[model samples]
Target: MVQNPETIQECIEKARQRLYQIANQYPDLWHPEVIRQSMVLDELINEYNQATRLKKTIKI
Candidate 1:
């Protein structure tokens, strides 16, 4: 299934906000929970990048 770029952007924003909230609660950057949230954000970013790249590469 094709994913909407806008939807992916929204997910990225939500994940980024969640990561920031988690970081604020846990000052330790390496805390497991914080690290987990960071990873989640990273994955969203990667997905967004891939989706956008696919849009650019596809020929009509």
Candidate 2:
């Protein structure tokens, strides 16, 4: 399994690249599992971004 990137931008770019690859290769065969995985990855990226924002707001 591919590991997620540490930075939010890298994580998003990597997920987008994966989705593009799948879309190109499977054209009309959009698998439900792949879409689900993409959604999960997006959720993870969003969570990471939220955590990072919170960390930045902490003065100490």
Candidate 3:
């Protein structure tokens, strides 16, 4: 597994760049790999959003 990114946006951008590279280098294997990366990115974004929202609520 890859290490967790410091920020959600950065993680998603890096994953997308990797997905693009994989799609270009290995077209046949791109399908499964892209799906996996996309899922992970989605989860990271969701978790980040939730954490930020919780922090805001606590501050108020």
Give the per-residue Cα lDDT of candidate 3 at 11: 73
For 1-60, candidate 1 gives per-residue lDDT tens digits of 557789989998999999899999999999999999999989888888888888988944
lDDT of 3: 0.70
Misplaced by over 4 Å in model 1 are: none
Q: Candidate 1 lDDT (Cα, whole model)?
A: 0.89
Any runs in candidate 2 off by more than 4 Å, and if so which?
Answer: 1-6
Q: What is the C-alpha lDDT of each candidate?
A: 0.89, 0.68, 0.70
> Which is the winner by TM-score between candidate 1 and candidate 3?
1
Cα lDDT of model 2 by residue, 1-60, tens digit? 223235666767777788777767666545875686579678868767676667667746
On the 0 to 100 scale, the lDDT of residue 44 in model 3 is 75
Worst 10 residues of 3 by lDDT: 1-10
**Residue 22 displacement (Å), model 2:** 0.6
- Rank the candidate models, highest TM-score first: 1, 3, 2
* Cα shift from native, residue 18, model 2 (Å): 0.9
Q: Model 1, 40: alpha-carbon shift in Å? A: 0.4
